[model samples]
Target: MKDKIQSFFHLEEHGTNIQTEIIAGITTFVTIAYILVVNPSILGDGGMDPGAVFTATAVTAAFGTCLMALSTNYPFILAPGMGLNAFMIYTVVLSMGYTWEVALAAFFVEGLIFLVIALTNIREVVLDAIPLSLKFAITAGIGLFITLIGLKNAGIVVDSPSTLITIFPFHSSMQDGSFATGGISALLGLVGIVITALLMIHNVKGNILLGILITWALGLVCQLAGVYVPDPAAGYGSLIPDFSRGLSVPSMALTFMKMDFSQVFSVGFATVVIAYLFTNISETFGALVGSASKAGVLQEDGKFPRFKNALVAQSVGVLTAAVTGTSATTSVVECAAGIAAGGKTGLTSLVTGIMFLISLLLSPIFLAIPSFATAPALVIVGFLMISSLLAIDFSDMSEAMPAFICLFTIPFTYSIVEGMALGFISYVVINTLGGTERRKKVSVAMYVIALLFVAKYFFV
Candidate 1:
């Protein structure tokens, strides 16, 4: 059974090993759960009803991932997306006040563009032409930015209307010396217990995810029972998503077409394309490597296009959203949590897809998980994200300063792209002025991306 399942996941990296496959699969799901939630929350930034959008998220996640599984034997999961969601909502929608339909129309168009990129081999050209180190930095840097946003949203960081930014407060409602404080403290204690047990107690393989799951389960149980555990405010309810009646793409499509398409093209194809393409590259690459490693589908040369197919299918997902009446991008990492629970191969994804298809009957199930429960998960993810900074070439102040600036700017500015833009821009300036001979083939790509960031933020 173990060998068969191992073969099914295709976890042969440089070489195949079942034990490694198990570890990779579990870790990938753990990471993916957070990634899934990443896009949804960012998409929620626009003025859409979180409830309705969550429903859309469920549907798109189901359909898109199923298509990927069917189209490819690889295990990369698909869903609404992350960077694009933020680009659309916080940047495009919030900045311009565009209609959801228009924003989605832009998304659909971008998806088509993505398909063009994927089908025409531009995808591999870009990925191959890009330097692995820069890509690594971008991925990790994005991770840091993501963590900061999560922390900021959770009130781990508070903004000062005057001086710019500040940390947690000394006293307030959430800060009161009440049962709430005690409860969170207790929860922290439990988390400590989890860390301790994983590190010190048991010899279990996936202890990290297990700790997170136990916390999630406990948090959910308390919230559902209305048990006012630590944070009463951190409650998650089974709010239903009313998508009854078979499927109604016509109505959804009409609503979608009415959205703004002007900003998409007018915003300069270069900038949008980079954000869209690079976002797809980084996000899908992460998912593919993760799912492939977990699924054991790696070829001898590490060729795994399951991610490409999954991502390519996402262009269709964007179209589906336009017709499905939702503002989401792709599957939430919590979906991966379900995968982590004994899911193997495309079968795990198919089951998840089915569950998503039948989500209307279980919108409550989706709503049952609260942010506070996921808070620790996000916090842990943030830590993981920030840790990637360790790879930055810190020996030189030029490389170190810009990377550090980008790292810090995320939580302070409350934006990932902004941080990335600033980081890339800063990297260019520093490298140019400092005359660092050490670089890669992708530096030009970095410069191209950096220029786009400048235009998007300043000019646009």
Candidate 2:
């Protein structure tokens, strides 16, 4: 069995053993498992059953991850994207007054469009057309973006009206001897970051995975000692796994096969579909670029191997998501956590996919992993990704400026596609105007993409 597994996944060629791959997979799974709980809660506001959304979300994620493994043999994880879900619920359903069913139909049509595009050379060409500097910028940008995500999740950072962002109020809250909910969690997050950093400095194996478990264990101990109080109202709930609800999988009856295509030809629906397509394609491209770069899998031309296969898997995953009654599915940024842990081949993704399947019965245990625990891992991974910036040729402002824009916009705007759009636009405009020689270097694909982005911003 071991030999067959190694042969199929090319584990030896990838310089990863089964044990390492499994550990990487588990780390990725735990890091991203929060989506199971969060997705349902977000979608439920549109009057969809939260329980059904949970099941559908898990199912779509498993399908996408496994398909990615089988097709590309790269350790990329997929799920219902956070931003896409919010767009569907808030912008499409609630704000636009469209029923949740109509929104699903829009996503369904987007999936069909994705399927057609994946069958062609367009997607791969666009990915290859991205300048090498911008590719590195995307990596660093995503790194900073996810790092900010870690900070927000751990409560280490909070919104500020005065400055736009501020550190958690540890000083003032501690003086009163009654720590605020966010303050305590933020404090724990800082400690976790230190502990994880120490583990890394010591060259400890599985340092990230260990950091998460240790942080969660400490939170549990603090709860016992009453230093960390659970404030359910503030989104800080009990650390203990609640098995009172039983382990039976939630039924998907409420949302299964619920798509309504009645508004498919309407103008508003076309806008919705275009928005989904733009975001989905751009986000998938950005994620693939970052993950492949981190895994050392990108070819010299800045394209990854088996590119079409990966897109096919992503498109199929989106179709599965729409059919299962959820939002569009795409490659997630959390796969970097596994690559940081030494995952190189598809086996890692296979393990993550299996875990998502297992979570069907063990939801309580997986869902109980607090965001603060995973925050440390994400923070560390973010640093590793940002190191790509050191490779850029900052001496050339033409390249450096666009790279800088992409790197800054990703974290600040909190959208990978958004960052990529502005970066591409800036890259094309700058390089085209640099000189006649530089204009000759810009590919037709780059020009076309820049025009599309401009049109998207202006018309759409």
Span of ten consecutive residues with least summed lDDT in model 1: 248-257
Candidate 1 residues lying further than 4 Å off, grouped into runs, are 1-42, 81-88, 91-103, 161-258, 268-273, 305-311, 321-344, 390-402, 432-447
For lDDT, the strongest prediction is: 2
lDDT for each residue of candidate 2 in 1-460, tens digit (9 for 90 to 100): 9999999999989888999999999989877876775576558667898768878999999999999998999999999986677668756786667899998998889998888889986765655666778878877887787678778878889889998888887888788754746777888888989999999899665577678778888888888888889998877888887888899887888888899999887766776786577667767887887899999999898867888888899999998998998889989878988999999999999999999899899766545667788678768868977887998999988889999998898677765555767887899999899999778768997787677667656654
lDDT of 1 at 433: 68
List model 1 lDDT by residue over 1-460, tens digit each.
8666546545353243544434434444444443333334455546655556666666677787677656664344566654456556654466445556566666666667767776776777667644443445555655655544544544455468986656555355355654343344335334534462554245444443455456556654554565444444543233222346434321223333454566666654345445555656665666566656655556778886455676667667666765555543443333344344434455455544665555445444333344433445445554554555666667867667776766666445545456566777877777776654744322676777777777776666
Off by over 4 Å in 2: 1-54, 68-114, 175-180, 201-207, 251-307, 322-352, 415-418, 456-460
Best by TM-score: 2
TM-score quality measure for candidate 1: 0.70
